[model samples]
Target: MVADAIYSCLPDPKEISPVETAPDPEDYQFLAVGFWVDKGTADQKAREYMTKIRNKKIGVFGTLGAYPDSDHANTVRERVRELLKENDIMDLFLCQGKVDPELVKMMAETMKDDPHHSMTPERRARLKEAEKHPDEDDLKNAQKVFEQIMVSLNN
Candidate 1:
């Protein structure tokens, strides 16, 4: 979704700039960027561009489009291998189209454990007041129902 969010913000592919400064690998240590490559660009030239990004110490990650390849799978693999070898870049790999159900369950479990994903502190404080004063039975019941839904998702 980060890719979608970033892509939606872009004005035009040309305006996005062909080359970006090597982002600090540590700051963007596990970053992944997906883009559409022009069919005319030679694989060698593409590898050269990836090398430039690698020199900046950022881990360059991307996915290749299938449409350009006559033998799509093999072409993608060969191109990926060529880029890896030439760029001295590691940790680059293909990305999946959607999150799996298992991953969704895992995310649900993670959200339950992480307080930062929960209600805001101010909201929690108000809820705490409600708990002590025992007002608004309907709101309390709704909170219980929300908690059940979260629990069910993880299960």
Candidate 2:
């Protein structure tokens, strides 16, 4: 959804490609990579792609299970920044996304024995809150952010 929102605002002559099937960076003047955060870090594929991209204007947008402005989200953002510190990151945007109930259930079962398990009441509540997100407002904000990114890329 975030990628769709960003694509909606991007100029023509643009192509969206998956990181697995990435095209040559030299073929495009600007690039935007979007991914879902997993285990508190940018997706591994995104990190790998970043390593191959250099000397291009780049923007990153992604979704997480945490609220967009939460401390956890901020830390994830900082981690992404560090990961791409060698590249020219034009902007970074993140928003909350629904957690998979199946994954949550599996995690809960796996952590049932651990005292410091992640399936705490607070975590479950946060996951519940995430179910409503990447909502209309989130998509709109993603579009706006990418629109500005496009403008910056043009300049």
| Poorest 10 consecutive residues by lDDT, candidate 2 | 112-121
Model 2, position 86: C-alpha lDDT score: 72
- TM-scores of the candidates in the order shown: 0.29, 0.90
* TM-score of structure candidate 2: 0.90
lDDT of 1 by residue, 1-155 (tens): 32333333333321222334434333432223333233422245445555544432223223333222235435564566455453433333332122234644564567766774444555344334433322244224333433443344346
The prediction achieving the highest TM-score against the true structure is: 2
RMSD vs true structure, all candidates: 21.6, 1.7
Model 2 residue 155 lDDT? 79
Candidate 2 segments exceeding 4 Å error: 113-116
lDDT of 1 at 6: 32
